[model samples]
Target: MPDVMPLVTAVDQLADRLRSLPQSRLRQGAAAHGLDLARELSARAQRLEFPDREPRSVPDEGLFVVADQVAVTGRDLAEAMRTASAHEVAEAVKLVEEAARRCEGTG
Candidate 1:
């Protein structure tokens, strides 16, 4: 099994940052960015877990839940990719890290 701890840690840190952000910051753009990332991660997980099935979109439950959405979707992806190729896992990690970086200055 590929060690997916790095992905887990990255998402945890990103979620923490999102949670700590002020309401103004979240409202400005952070929440949207987080939700986008969550949806992407969720899509990837669904594709990996069930290639033949249609992926469901993660809903927008307001800014307050963005952090939880990111964390939950990310972990779901990590779990789905547990048996995936190392390269594939690395790509997912990179995707998440890049999302975190992009969220550094949300609007």
Candidate 2:
């Protein structure tokens, strides 16, 4: 608690490093998920359109594309989530080890 600067700096560096990753790699699952989420949201939004508003099939078609994307993203996310727990456990162990080292050094 006395000094959080190192943690903040570490987090910032990690974020910057992540930001430097290739866009294609970053968006690997995004297009699909974005399209899906957008489609679902659009469908819900369309239903809220004014009763007298002119019908638009074009929007519906666009939403279909989005829905497809969402499906792809969902699949990717599910796989990632499944593997993520293991990674989380490893990271937690690493953090504990690092903290123990620091405590020993200080003591």
Candidate 3:
């Protein structure tokens, strides 16, 4: 049987990181969406019965939220990229990359 603990741990860590990010419009939106995804994953993990014939895998519900976050964050970042100062542009790029990485299961 595949171990699901790592996936759960990753999701939890990503959620915590998102929550603790600085309070910018992009981070705020992503944090809210990420927390919702994390809550859903936690709830699903608690309900798993691990029956003998079942396949062990993390639930896909969080994927939708991740995609949503990416879209929203990407849009916001694009706006920042268009007019922000050098430091702000760099920060926006970092935020967008982080969101994409989380969606790709590498964050």
Candidate 4:
């Protein structure tokens, strides 16, 4: 299995940042970005775990749940990628890293 600590770290960091954001900030754009990232990550995991089926969309459950959604989805992706190729793992890492950078608003 590939080392997934990097993905874990990146996603954890993003989730913590999102959780710490003030409600005002979350309302501004943080939650939106977090939700987007969560949705994308969820899709990636679904594809990894079930490539034959169309991935379902992660619902917009509201701003408050964004952080948890992101965290859970990230973990799900990490789990699904455990049996994946190195290139696939690297792609996931890159995705999380980019999302982290873009989620600066949540920090």
> Evaluated with lDDT, which candidate comes out highest?
1
Name the top TM-score candidate.
1
Q: Whole-model lDDT for model 2 versus the true structure?
A: 0.35
Q: Which ten residues in a row have the lowest lDDT in candidate 4?
A: 98-107
Q: Could you tell me every candidate's TM-score relative to the true structure?
A: 0.96, 0.26, 0.34, 0.91
The residue-level lDDT of candidate 3 at 88 comes to 46
Residue range 20-91, candidate 3, lDDT tens digits: 455563343654455444344333333332324433332334333444443333443333234334554454
Tens-place lDDT per residue, model 4, 1-107, is: 98887888888998998898889888888888889989999999999889999999989999899999999999999999899887887878788778777777344
lDDT of 1 by residue, 3-95 (tens): 888889989999999999999989888889999999999999999999999999999999999999999999999999899988888898898
Relative to the true structure, candidate 2 has a C-alpha RMSD (angstroms) of 17.7
- Candidate lDDT scores, in order, read 0.92, 0.35, 0.41, 0.87
* Reference-based lDDT, residue 23, model 3: 54
How many clashes (backbone atoms < 3 Å, residues ≥3 apart in a chain or on different chains) does model 2 have?
4
| TM-score of decoy 4 | 0.91
lDDT at residue 69 of model 2 (Cα atoms)? 37
